[model samples]
Target chain A: MHEYSLVEALIGRVEAEARRRQALAVHGLSIRVGELAGVDPELLRTAYETFRAGTVCERAELRLTTRAAAWVCPSCDAPIERGAPLRCPACEVPARLVEGSDALILDAIDLEVP
Target chain B: MCTTCGCGDTELVPVELHEKILAGNDRTARHNREHFLEAGVLAVNLMGSPGAGKTAVLEATARAAASKGWRLGAVSADLATDHDAVRLERAGIPSRAITTGQACHLDAELVHRALHDLPWRQTDVFFIENVGNLVCPAIYDLGQAANVVVLSVTEGEDKPLKYPVMFKAAELVLISKADLVPHLDVDVAAIEDALARVMPRPERIVVSARTGEGLDRWVAWLERRRLELGLVGRIAGLAGHVHPPGARGDRPAG
Candidate 1:
């Protein structure tokens, strides 16, 4: 539901960055959304489709990648496996998230520069 | 359609910019956090499902807050109306409400704007009742010092597991409406156990607004956090800004 807002913001941010870089138009957009970022990839795609019209990103191909923040041992820095115990088998301590957050990062932009 | 050379007089340059898409939101949230800190207020974000008894929990806590001589104010965000704010007002907490037209979650910007309408400076504790949706609200930071989720007993015990993001974001979970637990087949212990699945050691307490059960512990939790504010005024350091490795610093807001 908030995908529209996020996409709207994404397009605006991307367009502004493109203009700042003196690009004629954006040709490709790349973004990474963490699974815990609460953005559904399919829904985000739909939002991007709806919101990209007439913007600098119009006709621009969007490359969206999604991932999860890993849980790692706080003491040993060992990565915890999926479906594994919350504790680190090596460290024998509870595991913690590598990044407790999942903020989406705009990776790169392919722009049509003048 | 390009000519034989396929030249459109435009060079396709790849700009390697690794920046957060929600950087804008994060900057605003950091600003909001600074504002709250400056006002000497401990802001709490209360989120849950629409009928999860968020407002009711606040209502239940109002009397305790009053007796403790705590200045309380609330900013309520709902999709359609300011009814939640009114409910808080009736319960003796001064409140301002924002009706999010289409946004499913109350972003930091909305909370920032609403601060002007609220008595933020005079309040000891400022509660922002996020729009009643578990999924979207968990992702956005409203610059609150604490994030508390209310899960009523009427809801499924597996909610914490289903909505791990929301449950994980919460510093504390309230098993709201504990009085109704006897009538339903829901198990409070199971809910707590499910919370532990997502949050290694989930900090939770069961409560009911109707019978005043477990509210004392709830108030104590708030009191403990409020007291800690003196020692940790810079909630800015708590979790607002965690830059990724080699990531660029904040972009100047336009």
Candidate 2:
């Protein structure tokens, strides 16, 4: 999986935050992956499992959620359903993804602070 | 019952981060963009398949840019060889080679380091010729104002349909090796239609480095896009674009 590098980046970001906050240990973490981010959750989870050991996230549980790409027609305000093609079923123009999708985000970190 | 089994955790505080996993890379890429602007350079992230003729296109581009007086710099990446850099330099473009080793794509760190190796003062347009893979390269932002994908006729027309994410990431698609169109049974229109289905519908220009087809169009696109991206104005003001206050994720150091 291309996930190995992504896992490396993910772990580093968490480690940086853990160090900055003076956390004793990381207990848990939650992340949001967009559908268009090209990351499979299971693959990411497995990748994370391999890389997390021995890091600040060694004992931390990962919670992953997917953010659906909210596709809207160029002219329409309403969103098309999930899995819709890149077209407005109604307007037939082009579809655009609203903000907040296509990103892999760390939602929260459960850390043990001194 | 809240365990799910962290099971009666003693003292774990929930810290809200909402940070993007790519935020670190994004931050560095933003810095690279500002640095490019400092030298009046416009950057392009060029990505494509392994044999999609990216080096050939750059060679052709160098030849085309000469008459127009466009100064081009390249940071070329491959898994093992510096052959592309050699080829580009032979073509008269100032080029640096980055051997990515096991990495399938070029990240901001490599680009940042490679930037120093380029002749910044001589470069008005810089190209980060990404490790030639259609997938991983699209996900990376190398501080480029334009993302161009090169797809050759040999690769087939339906590649964009099969690889949506990479195609979707492109701002421009170069249909390379157009000289082979008459011999091959591929339908260029089908390729264009597939791209239209991709979100943001990237603009495409068909070109052949061998026959010099559409190279002028490609060069003109670069010239037009450089202006569109406001390189001149950014370079005019000594202290133009600063890193956005929140562009960096919230670490105390940030």
Candidate 3:
């Protein structure tokens, strides 16, 4: 899965951060995945587990949070819920996606420092 | 000695680093985009499933564009072979093949490397035909001006619904193999309906590369896109700007 490649990128970033902070090891990582980001959280965790060996995140706990896709009404600026009609509830006009489509963020990291 | 933790002399710190996981790739993609824009090259990322005629469509397009005196270049990615690149070269276009050892999708970094290998200045329109899988490629940004997803009629009409991410990410969708429609049980209308349901007002084109059925229309669309990207003047000296086929405005057939 593409999750493996993403995990690899995540590890690279974690390693760089850890090195910059003079941290000995990473204990945990918190990530936010958006629903429309096209990533599987379970697969990402599995990939992390498989690839973290001998790295800074060897024993790091991978915590993933998901964000739902959001759409905004162009006519009235109302937030439209996912799976709802594309039309805005307030203005009865087609809605536009404003945010929540991407969430590949590493919110925080727990590390063991000197 | 740490006051907060009982463990002897070991400090456990929680660092607040709000960084994106794919930031590296995104940064590279942005760089690639800048490179293309600076060169005035219209880079298009062509994506489709294996056997979806991605290469065939590119080959046909290259041939037609060459005939019109427009210089085209291509980069094809696959697990192990250079066959697609060879085919494009045979069609008289400068092409390179990025042999991804085990990568499923072509990332921006790989594409950036491939872009350097090509004589991009001489090329007006550049196409990056990504690996055949539809799932992984949807998430990757190849720094292309447009993402064109091709689906053959032989594939099920529900493919768009089945792979919503790919369909949703597509800037344009091409339903290939229109010539085979008379022989197959495929319903092109159903495919269009499925795409419309998943995609937000998708611009779809139906073409048959084998019989040159919609090649003119496809080229015309490419020419229009080139003009929109402000690349017409750059290539005008080489190609003299042929009139775009009138069929370019033909809507996706129901």
Candidate 4:
């Protein structure tokens, strides 16, 4: 799965950051993913564990912030709930998807500089 | 071995490596995109569930391109066998099969390799027919000019709602197997309604590959795109310069 590859990148970025900060141990890593990002959290977590086995982040925790697929109708101005092909409910217009979904951001990391 | 400060032991020291897992592929994908731009070739990545009639649509479309004299080639991704490639080759277009072993989708690296291995210097348009899966392929980039997501009426109308990412990412949507509209219980309107919600308004084409239904519009659409991409001009420049003699010949080379 592509999650494995994504996890590898995350690990590499964190490792680099850790090295720059002179951190001896990383406590955790945080990522924000949206509902519509089309990624499976379970699979990603599984891949993360396997990938972290020999890395410094082996003992670090992963924090994920999930956002929902919410939208505001460009025509009706009504807030659309998270649904397949998100649409506006009130005016029957194609709603403009706002921001809870389709996110793949590496927000921050927690580490102890020794 | 561990007698002296345990230094002789295979120390399992864990190095903290925090990273996004998709970073590697994303880097490759970006490289692949740049490559397509440099080559001046448009790549269209096709994705959909199995039985969505991807092959049939590709076959009909390639056949229609014959009279137009457009240089078209295809790389069909599957887990095994070159059946789809053979089918496309029979239509007088150069095509190849990409077996992904047990992988579910076509990744950028595979496509990058395929481009180098194919007769890229001759062809103007290339299509990467991804393995028949909706979930995995959407996440991988194939250095495509456009991404097409094909849906059939036989599948549930809630498909778009169920798989929002695929619908949203697609530049075009083609509803296949439309000839069975009368027999099936599909709510075409509902599907469109769902698509409107999740994605920007995408060009929607309804066609039945079996009966040659709605081929003119589809072909015209392709022609319009070809014109937009300057396909004729690009191929003309390469006709005598790059294309292999056999490929440039009037007869089908393969």
Model 1, B1-254: lDDT tens digits are 23558766767888888887778998999989876765557899999999999999999999756677777899998989889999999999999989998888999999988877766777778899999998999888878899999999888988887888898788999999899977999888888778866775578989999988898898889889877776233233232333324332232211
**What lDDT tens digits, residue by residue, belong to model 2 across residues B1-39?**
235666655466899988888888999999887777555
How well does candidate 1 reproduce the true complex, by DockQ? 0.50
Residue B184 accuracy (lDDT) in model 2: 94
True-structure RMSD, every candidate: 6.9, 6.1, 7.4, 7.4
The whole-model lDDT of each prediction reads 0.82, 0.82, 0.83, 0.75
Model 3: lDDT to the true structure: 0.83
Q: After superposition, how far is residue B223 of candidate 2 from its true place, in Å?
A: 1.0
TM-score of chain B of 1: 0.86
Clashing pairs in 3: none
> Which of the numbered candidates is closest to the native, going by highest DockQ?
3
lDDT tens per residue, model 4, B1-254: 34558565432233433333456667788877655544446667889998898888888887666677667889998999999999988976689999988888887888878877787646666778999987878877666767888899888888887787888888788899999999988877877887775576656888889888877777787667656764445434444243344443442322
Tens-digit lDDT track of model 3 for B115-175: 7777865777889999999899998887899999999999999898778788778888989
**Span of ten consecutive residues with least summed lDDT in model 4 chain B:** B10-19
* Cα shift from native, residue A86, model 3 (Å): 5.4
**TM (B chain), model 3:** 0.87
Model 3 per-residue lDDT tens digits across residues A1-114: 999999999999999999998987889999998877878888988998999998888899998898877777787887776544456666766557666565678989998987
What value does the lDDT take at residue B25 in candidate 1? Answer: 91
Evaluated at residue B56, the lDDT of candidate 3 is 93
Clash totals for all candidate models: 0, 0, 0, 26
DockQ of each: 0.50, 0.43, 0.55, 0.22
After superposition, the stretches of candidate 1 with alpha carbons farther than 4 Å from their true spots are: A78-92, A99-103, B1-9, B231-254
